[model samples]
Target chain A: MTYCVGMVLDRGIVLMSDTRTNSGVDNISVFRKMFHWAVPGERIISVMTAGNLATTQSVISRLEERSKTPEERSNSLLELPTMFQVAVETGKLLRETVQDTQSENGEQGKGRFTASMIVAGQIKGMEPRLFMIYPEGNFIEASFDTPFFQIGETKYGRPILIRGYDRNMSFEDAVKLLMVSFDSTLKANLSVGLPLDMMVIERDKYEPAHEQRIEATDEYFLSVSSGWSDALRTAFHSLPNFSFGQPGNG
Target chain B: MTYCVGMVLDRGIVLMSDTRTNSGVDNISVFRKMFHWAVPGERIISVMTAGNLATTQSVISRLEERSKTPEERSNSLLELPTMFQVAVETGKLLRETVQDTQSENGEQGKGRFTASMIVAGQIKGMEPRLFMIYPEGNFIEASFDTPFFQIGETKYGRPILIRGYDRNMSFEDAVKLLMVSFDSTLKANLSVGLPLDMMVIERDKYEPAHEQRIEATDEYFLSVSSGWSDALRTAFHSLPNFSFGQPGNG
Candidate 1:
């Protein structure tokens, strides 16, 4: 399982993904789920994937291969006119990969090879765009009312996002909010592990503003995890207590 | 759908349940999920249920009916010598109820009529106990390491319980902890709704020490919900920001 979140904030886009993939409890491995491509001031795109590892790897590799060949440059990420086009083409590749794998493995494997992705980035002239692409080649873009998308192991981290998200918040605060969300998921589920990949894309930059790998021993991540827990305890203690209506209690 | 939680602490026990039941989103209604039976100084038992509402209602009704009849009183909740016996008997009744309903409806209804329960209480001379009874007439008791059990829509709220649970905490603190857990679940899910039922049983007392129905307009609950959100935002801001490694940024 993987847990990834991408936010389309006013300042830019923040994308975070955990690097844990498991076939079973004993067969767990670390696999980077975030892929990025940049052509300096022309275009920048990042894809965060969840679901079938094989399918996502195939789709990503095909995109990379096409980007390198002059003959396929028209359909490559580097040449996509807009982020929406990149998302559409990425979804198509994902669906085709799943279909090919299913046919190779036959009928019983029909739904076994499936993957979903969050595509976010910008072209020089257009504003930053974010989209959640489904396994069936359909996709939905983020809106003002719902400026974020999460995939895989999402429920545990969702309450924090619902309560704390602000569309106009700073990029620093956006990263902080996502860290809390990911920390909540990490504590509740063993399937999602550490060594997180995070990218920040400032609006109109057409390149990554910042990117980092948050390992288990990262000081700032540890501080956020423990600080959030302590803050919750303090907040709980500050709440008004339920008064009993019994004799001498109220 | 429902959300119910029960915890065994060093001081005693705390149980809470949301009052929502739905066949579908359009068919939601408020229904109390907590039931209690007590003989004052003899014993006190509370059952918090989740899953099929019809099955749980039938099980509770049967227990109540048997407890009222003089001839069947020997096998009733009032006659059970220990909390473990009460749990075992409750599991049996739950299994019987599901089996009867399925038989009446035939093969297509095999798993449609099923419910689970958290049974917590104490008999004179025994310590307070907690058990989660499955639909199969089997149950597991909570241990010191895992002193709480939650049923239905449990994942969203589980992280708080994992981080905040303390066996030595006061009953008031325990209630506060569960309020946070339930509030988290309530926000993320539409199926778990307002007007929660809470009960506390002090060890060896054999009766409820406090009980309340928390409505939507309840001031204390409102404070906890809003305060928790504010505290999280503050905590997020207090964490160190991720510094870019470019020139003049560090």
Candidate 2:
């Protein structure tokens, strides 16, 4: 399992991904799930993947390798005219990757080799956009009513995003909200681990505004975790007492 | 779908369930998911159901009808020697109900009529106990590590319980925690709706301590919805600002 979230705010786009993969409770490993590509000052694109590591690796490898071979990379992610087109190209690539792998293995019921991605960024002059790519290689863009998209182990972390997200929010606020969302997922799921990959793209900057790998012992995250627990405990105590009704009131 | 939670605490047990059923977003209706029985001073038991409504109703109807029969009510829930036995009987009833329904339909797939339950209560001589009954007629009791069990749309509401729940928490505190959990679920899932049913069983007391139905407009719940949104916003802003490697010579 994995948890990755992206918010498209007025200030820019904020993306965060956890780095944990597990075959079972006893077999757990850390693997970075966030990937980025930027033609410095031209275009900056970021994607975070979840579901079937092998499938995601194949899709990403294809994308990266295309960057080196001009002929093989035509109509690829980097050359797309707009973010929407980029998503379309990436979705096509994902579909091709899955079909090729299954045919080579000849596995009858591999159950779709599930994989999805959160793709967000800007093209030279286009607006920053956010999209959630589905396992079927189709995608949906974030709109005014939904300015953020999440993939993988999403339910556990959805409440924070629903209540705290603001389209007009500053990039810093967006990152903070993402941390809280990721924190919830990390605590509830053992398959989602630490040392998160976080990146921020300032509007029209065409380059990453900030990027960092958050380790388990990072001071900010430690404070966020402990502080949230304390806040919740305090809030729990402050709620009004149950009336329980009078003996005759039932 | 529904959202029901049961907690076993040192003070006693807290059981809460939402009354919402939906076949899809378009076809939704209100249907209580909680049932209770009280042999006034002898025993008090509350069962909350989730999953197939037809199966749960059949299981509860059978249990209810048996309690009224003189000769056939021997291993009935009310006559059970301990709370654990009561749970086992409920699980067996649920499994039997599913089996009968499946055979009637002549289906060869996994029984779609299966249901899960959270049973919590007290018998005269024993302490309060809580059990989560699976569709397979098997059950497990709540322990210190996991003092509460939730059924139905559980994920959205899980974080509050994980962070605020304490085995020794006051009965009032536990109810509030349950409400928050329910609030989270209600906000995130349309399949789980209003008019929640809640019952409290006090330690060693064989009758329900408190029972009430919360309407959609209940003031407390309204406050919880808005107050929680405000709290999230405040928490988001309170997180430390990220300067992200500002060339500070550190």
DockQ values of all predictions? 0.46, 0.46
List of clashing residue pairs for candidate 2: none
- Report each candidate's C-alpha RMSD, comma-separated, in the order given: 3.2, 2.9
Give candidate 1's whole-model lDDT.
0.87
User: Which 10 residues in a row give candidate 1 chain B its minimum summed lDDT?
Assistant: B241-250
* Candidates' chain B TM-scores in the order shown: 0.93, 0.91
**Which lDDT value does model 1 have at A215?**
84
Docking class of 2: acceptable
All candidates' TM-scores? 0.91, 0.92
> Mind giving the per-residue lDDT tens digits that candidate 1 earns over A1-250?
8999999889999999999999989999999999898889888899999999988998998887754676655537988777888988999999899888888999788788899999999999899999999999899999998899999999999988988899898887888888889999999889999989989989978788988888898777888888888876666666666556633232
lDDT of each: 0.87, 0.82
